[model samples]
Target: MKLSAETLADLHPEISRPAYDRSKVTAGILHVGLGNFHRAHQAIYIDDLLARGGSEEWGILGAGVMPADAQMRDGLKAQDCLYTVLEQDASGDKGRVIGSMTDFAPVSPNHEGILRAMASPSIRIVSLTVTEGGYFVSAETGGFNPDHPAIQADIANPGKPGTIFGAIVEGLRARREAGMVPFTVMSCDNVPHNGEVTRAAVLGIARGQDASLADWIDDKVAFPNGMVDRITPATTEARINHLREAFGLEDARPVFCEPFRQWVLEDKFTDGRPALEEVGVQFVPDVTPYEHMKIRILNGGHAMIAYPGALLGLTYAHDAMAHPLVRGFLEKVETTEVIPIVPPVPDTSLTAYFELIEERFANPRVEDTLSRLCLDGSNRQPKFIVPSAADCLKAGRSIDGLALASALWCRYCFGEGEHHEEIPPNDPSWDRLKEASRVARDNPAAWLQMSDIYGDVGQSPLFREGFTKALNALWENGTEATLQAYLND
Candidate 1:
């Protein structure tokens, strides 16, 4: 049967809340980019709070600013805004029906609805999961790009919004006009200083439209930096079938994720937020150290493995980790190069962190695909890997392993090999990157010249020499031999 409150109550007899009454206890918390990660992490936490008779203050009001999110909006609306989240880990898999999302404002076309929702006093916390790219940042300057066509369009037609930042600014403007308190903007993406980044994006657009409003937002709004981690892979038909068979429910948008979930936020919310702290959320004075640690270690390690594994024709992260060379590369690069550069992580040992990462990678049940990690290499590498390489270089240390990792990326971007497996198009700049790599093999200097993508790494003699060497070896000797050489070194 299709999943609903009654169906859920019947399937999970022990749940204390009657399925029908679950919707009545929700309050509005506007959520952008209603993707799998938000559904699994934040929605689940709020659902747990409601389950304990603790919250009627934080129900998610789902909003989607992109065309891709239209499907999610339709699926959630079909099920009364309720869906299942299946947690898969090494231990096993368990399904929980999440009911914390109350309503949907399809923002792809209905820009007015989004602005109204955000301005609503009921929406005390405006949370986002709009991946790193959505911020429209100039990767070179690490700042907002006002010259972007989308930003230009949004600024030109402020009343009819086209971007999330535009929508946020319009909402904040309305709140100010109506004499209402400003909403707290919480970023749940994996980018560093996500809150500050978002604030810049929002305020950057607002300043172009109205400088006074921008100043008002700067003074009144709370953009809490956050560290959010959960490995929720994109859902497929096979997963839907698995959920149906496992739980006797035909939920179309059931989320599948690893059992691990973590959220660390800077404690700054203005309009009163969820008692999420009561249900295991970590509210800290500063999220920078934790952010750096996770971004560099966990996310950076994923990038380190993705390209190398993909070129070697390995499909999943665990499978890649199972290979001795891939595992060793991960260990050497992470422990030797990556971790030393990162500031201390809170309350935990780096050894233990690496151990946990290895275990997570080895969880075959999650099937974290290498290609998933490999997507948008141009965007991912600068944030995830290049900084570590830079830090090591500044310290007069070797990043030979890191360089090899990057060379593997350059090879992967070539998009073809003897196997003839077509690399799926994932990057907005894929065509340019592919063409650039083709020329780069003959003249490594040509590739590094793309200042937009590679930044200082492109021009660095260290990166150039290391990249040229690694690329040449991999091209001439193949993945296994290149790996062996790196390992022996």
Candidate 2:
């Protein structure tokens, strides 16, 4: 089957497709980043909600903000905005064709179409999955960078926007002028307090233009902080071919993820929202406890293994987890240092949650790439790993493992692994990082002195001392031996 609305009925009998009429599904949400995570997580949830009936009006209207997003727009548009989502784990595989997205607006030169779509009264939610760097946040200040080129361009020509936040502000401005209720801005990224992060970015852009408009937005808009979880790997050619050969299905942008999924959101919306509660989306009063727990355990765990895995030339996350030294470092750091400060979830056990993360990381079938985990270290380190180190330092707790993790990141930027093999560029700030790593090879303090990444926390003597020792060990010895030394110490 070609996996279009027309050929969907001809798909394998076991494959699940949409049961409701696609025509009836209206645009109630306009998502900015139409990436694999959004497709696998939120789109799936909305798809499930629609299948249960009475939510046809809440369908998603996908929008692509970046120039690179045109590829996704074309791929989904070719198939009537339909795509396959394959979930794999030890338990089994479940393939579903998600039809939650009705269409994707073209990534215009000036983003006119996107602005119009955002201003639509039907769209009650304007969501985002633009990565941590996409928000134009400075790691040093922990705030929006007003000097970001894209934001500046958007502000200069307020009528025609450049970035997602620009488009969002324009959309909100238009809505306000039309006497309409503003849509809620939802952020589904892995960043801590993602909703607040998004709110700050949007407000940062809006306030730059007009202080009164910023005040109105500050009063009217609802940015709900939420916790989202799902391990979705990039869709490779091999996986795409497997979909075609195994299920007689062919799609351009199919998504692959672990069977496990979770979404805990704050029950705050400016406009009327869907009954996602009926389909297992937890709508709670607070999402901080859940957010911190996941950030420290799941995301922090990924960071703990990523650099070491890359340094060892490991290809997949599961393979990294299978290595005794690699898994030992992760387990030791997560348990002794990381998990100690994790806030209590309502009824969820932290130990059990960590166990689940371990299982997900080690799922061989998922084959989540170590490179994917290792990407964007400069932006990711401040968000994922540094928090644990800062918390441990603040609480006067042991931070050896956390320091080792940071050292591994700096060494990984040295652009080589064991046997001196070439490690490809990973972070957006790779050149600056590699330059610092080379300098720090002789004087390890140079790496920590990166005020942009480490900020004030990098100034702490405790972390500085530990990071220096780890970086030196990694240079003289190898990753495996250095990890062993840490464990033995």
Candidate 3:
């Protein structure tokens, strides 16, 4: 049977459906970029809160700004804004149909419906999961860059704004003009200090329109930083087939994710929020400690493994973890290098946290692609990999392993895997990166010379020395021999 509101009751007995009255649920939160992570993580939290029997008015209204989002919008509209989340681990595989999203607005060219939904008085919170690079903040300075091409376009045509921040600015302007309390702008992306980055993006656009609007948004609107975790791979045909074969249900774009999900948000909501705490959300006064730990350890760990595994033609993350050389390289980097720079988290052991992360990476059920981790190197390296190098250099520690990770990235960017397999362009700046990699083949320092991407990390003698040596070794010895060399060193 097709998965929809009408057929949900006939699903497998073990499959859970929304127990709450979907008709009574109203849109109080408007979430942008409703991808698999949002569906598997934040939306599920809202679903759980409602299942506990309260916060009906806090239901979600999904919106999308990008042109590709139209397909997602159309897919959900076909199924009554309902989708199944297949949460799987070694012990179990459970499916739950999520209905917290009362409805999704069909995407329009100029974001007409999204603007209307954003300006609606009933929507008290606007959250975002538009990815780390989507924030338009300069990696060099963690602040909004008005100079971004999209922001530049939005500046030229403010009325028919082109970016999410532009739409957000206009929506907040409409709310302010109509004498309504402003909704909070919560950022659930993995960037460091995401809420603050969001605030900068909003005000940077708003100030270009009017200083008064900028001040109001800065003072009244709340942008709360948060840490969100889940291992959700890009949807695959096998997953879609799994749903049909296992549950006897037909659905488009059903999410397949690891059972582990976590959200640590600071309690800086504007009007109100759901009873998310009851559903295992950690609401704290400060999310900094938690953010640093997860970013450096988990996110950084992914980056550390991504390139080397990609070079070796590994398909999935678990397969990479299973490789002895790759697994050993990750362990050495974390235990000796990455964890030392990470700040202490409250009531959490960093060593034990790393152990858990290793186990999570080793979970055979999650088919997280190494290429997924290898995507967006230009944005991810500075955020995930380079920062650790900077921290190690700042503390007068070794950056040998982190530099090897950097070397692997440069090698991976050369547009070929081992056995001469074509590694298609992955990053947004792939062309430039590939050319730099070719040049760095002879002059290895040329890769780190990208000041915009590497900044000060590229300038340090220790990092340059280590990166050049490791990158040189990889080019000559290949990934397997290169990793063994590093591990043996």
Candidate 4:
């Protein structure tokens, strides 16, 4: 049967269905990015909370500002915002229906429906998972990009704002004029100090429009920093078929992920929040320690493998993990370089955390594509790998492995894998990245001179030496030979 509230009663008895009343659940959170990660992570938490029988008013209203969101809107609405989450591990697989998302706004040109939903007094939290690059942050200053064309357009037409930041500013302005409480803006993206970044973007856009409005948002709206972890691969026809064959059901927007998930959030919500702590989420006074550990270790590990994996023609993440040379390179770099810079997090040891990360990456059932990891390297490498290199350089530690990882990225960007397969353009900065990669094949320092990405780290003598050497080795001997050298050296 098609998965919907109307058909829920007729589902197979063996399937794990929602125990709570979906009709009683009301929208309290307006989530901006209705991606699979949000559904698998945050929305699942809210679903579980409602299943426990109290937080009915905290259900989510899935929303999106981009035109691409029209696909998601139609899919979720067709299913009554009811989708299946299939969790897989070594042993078996389990499927559960997630109904925390009560509704999705119609995908319209002006986004009036989304703005109205955001202006609602019932929405206590405005959360987002709009990827790393969605915040309109300047790569040079690590601040809001007021000069971005989208931001510029929004500035030209404030009332009919186009970007997410502009929409947020307009919504907050409406709420302020109506004397309604400003909702807390929570960021669940992988960026460092995500809450702070969201605040900068929102307030930066608001300031350009109205200084007093920006000040009001700064003083009133709370942007809680959070660390969210889950491996949600992009849904595909094979996965959909697996669900249909396994459960005898049809769901257009089903999410497939590993069984493991973690969310560490700073307790700074302005209005109020669900008792997500009662579920699996960790609520803390500060999320920095947790954030650093996950971003640097977990996300850094992904960057470590992605380029080399793609260059080596490995298809899946587990394939890269199973490769001895790639695995060894990742271990050496993470343990020696990355983990040393990360402060000791509360209740967690860096070593044990790495062990968990390793196991999760090697989960055979995940089948996460290296292509997915390799996408948007222009944004991810700086956030995930560059910071560690900078920290190591300041501490006078060797950044050889980190440099090699960066070199691998340059090699991957050459638009050809080791198998001579044309690596399609995946990054927004593809033209410049391709040119730099082609030049860096002979002059490695040329790549580092892209100041928007490497910053002053490129000028460091040690970093330059290491990056140049790694790039030379990668060019001369290729990925496998260079990986072997790094492993043995």
Q: For each predicted model, how many residue pairs clash, with residues at least 3 apart or on different chains?
A: 0, 0, 0, 0
Tens digits of per-residue lDDT, candidate 1, 36-76, equal: 89998988888877777756767888888777678878888
Q: On a 0 to 1 TM-score scale, where does candidate 4 land against the true structure?
A: 0.98
Listed in order, each prediction's TM-score against the native is 0.96, 0.98, 0.99, 0.98
**For residues 305-327, what per-residue lDDT tens digits would candidate 4 score against the true structure?**
88898999899999999999999
After aligning candidate 2 to the native by TM-score, how far in Å is the CA of 453 from where it should be? 1.0
lDDT of 3 by residue, 1-489 (tens): 998999988999878999899999999999999999999999999999998886899999999988889899999989999999998889878999999999887687678887899778899999999988898977666568999988887767766788888888988989899989999999989889999999988888899888999999988999998999999988899989988998898999699999888999999977888878899999998999998899899998998888888888888889999999999999999999999889889999999999999999988887889999999989988888898899899999999999999999999999987788899989889999999999999999999889878989988999999999999899788999989998998
The true-versus-predicted C-alpha distance at residue 48 of model 4, in Å, is: 0.6
Q: Which window of 10 residues has the lowest lDDT sum in candidate 1?
A: 12-21
lDDT of 1 at 2: 81
Model 2 lDDT at residue 433: 91
List residue ranges in candidate 1 displaced over 4 A.
12-20
Q: Determine which window of 10 residues in candidate 2 has minimal summed lDDT.
A: 109-118
lDDT of each: 0.82, 0.90, 0.90, 0.90
lDDT of 3 at 189: 91
What lDDT does model 2 reach?
0.90
lDDT of 2 by residue, 443-464 (tens): 9998988887888779999999
Error of 4 at 351 (Å): 0.4
What are the C-alpha RMSDs, in order, of all predicted structures? 1.7, 1.0, 1.0, 1.1
